[model samples]
Target: MQLANKTIVVTGAGGGIGRELCLQLVQRGANVAGVDINLATLDETGRLAGVGRDRFAGFQLDITDGEKVSSLPAEVLAHFGVVDGLINNAGIIQPFKLVNDLSMDAINRVMAVNFYGTLYLTKAFLPHLLERPEAHIANVSSMGGFLPVPGQTVYGAAKAAVKLLTEGLYAELKDTNVKVTVIFPGAIATNIMQNSGLDVPNADAGSDSQFKTLSARQAADQMLAGIEKNQFRVVIGQDARAMDKLYRLNPKYAADLIQKKMRSLLR
Candidate 1:
């Protein structure tokens, strides 16, 4: 989708990939309505967006709030006058723990934000998007969504739902003017671990690995390219591409094989 003159709404715009996405969208000449639960972070995103007051704005919102999410289309319409694209990027990862050891509350929180939040926002915005001749929706899933990590079971489950949900949206919207894309990112260097309420030791370990994690800017760049191509799925980073290939070739073996290699990183 050509971003010029489009009004795009990006959730989780306070930090991490969400922040970078806003910056990139503005650079590409898109008007952005940045949304996040954290007002301070949203302000930072707005500053980074650097578009004039008319083209760049921030909204404080928790995507998991169905009532609030349902009410957003009108607000966005008022701000930008129309909604053309949406990036379902707001997400949270609960504490890294095995399924049996994980708390029910944690699991629920993860699902509420990662899965239901995306669903709510997408449903709320689909009608508005349909009105536009060239609209787009991009949902950010993780490599963990496709290849489960033992400790991050709940996060994996939530992102897995996002992956499938986006794919289904893509299939259903095949005949529509609205384009749908699902993004699977490898271990991008971001504050996701710290935000997950976990301590990340040697977070840089994956930075320069052969299966390198990407910077947020790189990930956002690829996402824009995917949107332009109208790709159904876009996998970012070396590790993400490798995992996608492995899982497609041998699902069972890919899981075990990845776990064996990644377990050492935790230690």
Candidate 2:
């Protein structure tokens, strides 16, 4: 769907891909409701959008709270008068460890933010989206969602759930006015470790790395292009595209390759 003159809601708009998306969407003539748990950073997204309050509004919200998420559509409508799209981008990663070594609390938190949060916001805004003449829903799922990453098992599992959930929505909504797209992004330059409250080695420290990480801006650009084209799935970065091919051709080899390359990061 064309973005011009549309009002779109983007979760996790405080920073990273979400922030970049907010800025780019405004440039395409779309009004944006930037939602995040961090009010300060969410406001910064509006500033970066370089638009007035009429075009960019920031809403501080914790999407994991179902009640609060359910209330967001009304609040956004009150500000923008209509909703044309929803982007489920809010998610967190787990600590680098095997599943048995991770705490139940950590596992649950990852699932809550990555999977359940997406579900809550989608259900809340789907009815409103359906009311529009045309609408779009774009969900961000990681490459780990499709491939196995040794140290991030829970994180991968959560994203995998998001992948299936988004695909199912696409199939069910095919006859409707709403369009759905799921994104598989390779490693992008972001402070996801800091956001998830974990410390990690520098991403570029691995000299033999096979993966090519994209910048946040590049990822955001790809996402917008996918949404505009109404694509069923979008794989960002050369790394993601390569892995998509590998996994489809040989799932076991793809899993082993990622495990071999990423094992050092877990150390």
Candidate 3:
């Protein structure tokens, strides 16, 4: 699971934690195949990585497209000659609304991006990964995946699916060389709201926000640590770590607390 001299494929490489992961993976002496839907931004990630073509390659891909996702393994292998790791990092948040108020289209989009998208890439690359002497698969779930946040109910559900899927993969692959990790990240400073086609309600009220936001780079660093160490799970931020413990200790209290904290975000 050491990153050095490995070929790691990271989705969502256009921005945020995915972009940072690509940069850091190369810094750790690994070649990276960076995937994202945005060509211009994915190219920017390649530029920012500042590595040679052999060290970094940007692939513009929509993970939701099963056909395209299935072909990615061959494409990436043609460039890197091998796939050593797969990090399912691309995801989108739901519009801030209760499930009753949200449209079916909105719910489906979130699931497509967060759950099925990860599933497609995982299924596509898992066989190749199994062939490696050592390989890693890390799926990025959310803190909300394990706890209920009233407004983002469906988003949480999709992430919850990812959480279970990753856990199952870990258990099934326990006897194999392919290591699996499930990543739970707390709030971090990124453009997820805008990317999700919405805006933060209290944009100018960072000081008043209850949760502390970590930098995207910090999140990427911690996420990759799980893979390097071959850990089964990695919780990135204080907010997520605290909630994980609280939810395990008192589910009802944890659920109520998050609902109260998240009320303002709902329409």
Candidate 4:
């Protein structure tokens, strides 16, 4: 679906790829409802968006709050009048620890933010999306969702759920005007580690890293392209694409390779 003249809602509008998505969507002629836990950062995103108040509106709310999520559509409609797309972009990573060593709080937080948060936003906006002549939904999964990462087991599981959730939504909406896309991003230079409250070296953007990572803007660009083209699935970055093909060919080898390369993060 074309972005121009559309009203789109993007979670995680505070920073990183989510911020980039909000900026680009508004620049592309879409009215954006920016949702984030940080009101200051969400407003910063609006400032950086370089669009008028009419083109962008920021909402501060935790997506895991089902009651608030259920009410978001009405609030968004009050601003943009009609919703055309929903991008489930807000998420957090779990600490770099084995699941056996992690707390249930960690596990639940990961599942709630990454999986249920996406589900809530999807459920809230889906009806409005369906009402439009053409609508799109894109959920950002991870390469970890498809291939195993040693220390981030729960994070992987949550993202894997998002992957399936998006795919299922696609299948269920195939006959409707609403289009769905599931995105798997490999590694991108973002502050997700700091945001997730983990300060491990090489977990995010740092000079010493196992693989090359894409910039947040680059990742956001590809995501928007996928939404515009109504792609069923989009794998961003060479690392994710390579891993996708390798996993398809030999899951054992892929898993072993990732375990070896990612084991250092656990320590």
Whole-model Cα lDDT of every candidate shown, in order: 0.87, 0.92, 0.92, 0.92
Query: After best superposition, candidate 3 residue 98: deviation in angstroms?
Result: 0.6
CA RMSD of all predictions:
1.8, 1.2, 1.4, 1.6
- Expressed as tens digits, the lDDT of each residue in 47-122 for candidate 3 is 9999889999988999999999999999999999999999999999987788889999999999999999999999
Worst 10 residues of 3 by lDDT: 202-211
Tens-digit lDDT track of model 4 for 1-267: 999999999999999999999998987899999999999999999999887889999999999999999999999998878999999999999988898999999999999999999999999999888889999999999999999998889999999999999999999999999999999999888889887877766643223545578999999999999889999999999889999999999999999988877756677
Q: lDDT by residue for model 1 over 1-267, one digit each (tens)?
A: 999889999998889888998898898889999999889989988887766768889989988899999999999898789999999988887775568888898899899999999999999999999999889999999988999776777899899999999999989999999999999988787898776677765534454467756788888889888987888899899888998998999999988976666564555
Tens digits of per-residue lDDT for model 2 on 1-267? 999999999999999999989999999999999999999999888878887999999999998899999999999999999999999998889987888899999999999999999999999999999999999999999999999988889999999999999999999999999999999998789878888888876653446767667899999999999999999999998888998999999999999888788766767
Candidate 3, RMSD to the unseen true structure = 1.4
Candidate 3, residue 163: how far the Cα is off, in Å? 0.3
Instruction: Compute the lDDT for candidate 2.
Output: 0.92
Cα distance off (Å), candidate 3, residue 214? 0.6
Q: Ten-residue segment with the worst summed lDDT in candidate 1?
A: 200-209
Candidate 1: residue pairs that collide: none
Per-prediction TM-score to the true structure, in the order listed: 0.94, 0.97, 0.97, 0.96
Model 2 poorest ten-residue lDDT run: 200-209
In model 3, which runs have C-alpha deviations exceeding 4 angstroms? 203-211
Taking all chains together, the TM-score of candidate 1 against the true structure is 0.94
